[model samples]
Target: MKLLRVGPPGAERPVVLDGTRYLDISGVVSDIGEEFWRTDGVERVQAALAAGTLPEVDVTGLRIGPPIARPGVVLCIGMNYATHAAETGAEPPEHPVMFYKAPNTVVGPNDDVLLPRGSAKADWEVELAVVIGRRARYLESPADALSYIGGYCISNDVSERAFQLETSGGQWSKGKSCETFNPLGPWLVTADEIPDPQALGLRSSVNGEARQDSSTADMVFSVAHLIWQLSQVTVLEPGDVVNTGTPEGVAVSGRFPYLRPGDVMELQIEGLSTQRQRLQSAEQEA
Candidate 1:
């Protein structure tokens, strides 16, 4: 089942998409949060849909919000793709390069990406995001890690290079945590539907020009490996999101130009779905 959150920003209601129509799950389930996915929420919704118990909703009239709400952590893997690492002139690390983005950065799929004040190197990175379903600790192997996954979604890893590298003594989080840095959703596709996350193709374009383009197959650290590695250090809880890193063709990769006001970003991954967002000046925030 493909789950989503629709309506205004703070008042989004749970919804499940069945073909071109939507079913309002708000009456059956509250919100698309940790509690929902941790339990048998997906199964329950599927059963309801199968039993013809879900009410048909008018998704066309509602605004969309990030499919998941209040994620415990926004964990990200840096340079997970070999080509992405090569494009940035970095060597592939033996272990995953991990970082954190505050949950406050999370926003809906179609929301505008703010070009933070004093920011000149605002960039775009299209990535595949993983939503954790169950608690996991010290995962024994890659196979063990796969069992913890709940679903997948499309994510835009908006970045500011100057703050990330030069201003913060090379800490990536400095450029990564700005408000509205993470744009997720449109839908949360169940794991069973995805079959193989690594085989999907992903691409991003800015103002109609292509920037990031690659497949999850190019990842240096596969999804299963990253999960296994992370579980060894920290417990993976329900509703935690993991951004598996972007591919080559990012603005910082030196092959393309950086983003500016009025620039639009469109991204898509197989099975997960597509998302589009326009860029606005930071002045809006002031």
Candidate 2:
């Protein structure tokens, strides 16, 4: 099932994409929140679709908001892509390196990505984000980890190198938590639809020039492993998001210039969806 949120940013209505048309399931369920997914929202929607008759809406010219509501936590894995780490002069991590992006940083997929005030060195990272379907605590192995995943979506992990490296001293969140940094969705392709999460192609481009082109196969710790590993340390609640990290060819490598105001970023994950973000200054947005 391809689930999405459409309409204006804050006033988005949850809907399911059926081919070229979008079904308005708002009458059946509210926002696609934690409670919704945890309580079998997807199945309920499927039942509604099976019944055949339902209200539909035109999404042309409408904004595509993040499919899920503000997640409980936006967990991230750093250097999960071996080649991406190499480009930044970092060694391959033996274990998944975890981090977080403030939940409030999330915004609509095509919304203008803001360049934080006094910022430079803003970069792009096209990543595959995993959304949890249910509560997950200590797990025995990576084997059952797939059961916890609800779906996958396209995510651009926008970063500011100066704040992440120079001014941050050691912490990266300072640079990662800028408002509108995480642009997600077009649709959340449910887990059942994705048989192999580790084999999808993901790529990104800046203003029509290709930047990162790689696959989830390059992840040091695959989605299942990351979920299982994280569960051993903390509780993975429903509606929590996990950014599986990006591939090579980021601006930080010096091969390309950092993102500046007026820059445009396009990102995609195979079989999922694509997103385009136009860069603007904080002042421009104001």
Best by lDDT: 2
lDDT of 1 by residue, 140-162 (tens): 89998887899999999899999
Clashing residue pairs in candidate 2 are none
| Global lDDT of each candidate | 0.89, 0.92
Candidate that scores best on TM-score: 2
Count of clashes, each model: 0, 0
TM-score of each: 0.98, 0.98
Model 2 clash tally? Answer: 0
Worst 10 residues of 2 by lDDT: 52-61
| lDDT over C-alpha atoms for residue 66 of model 2 | 93
Q: Which stretches of candidate 2 lie over 4 Å from their true place?
A: none
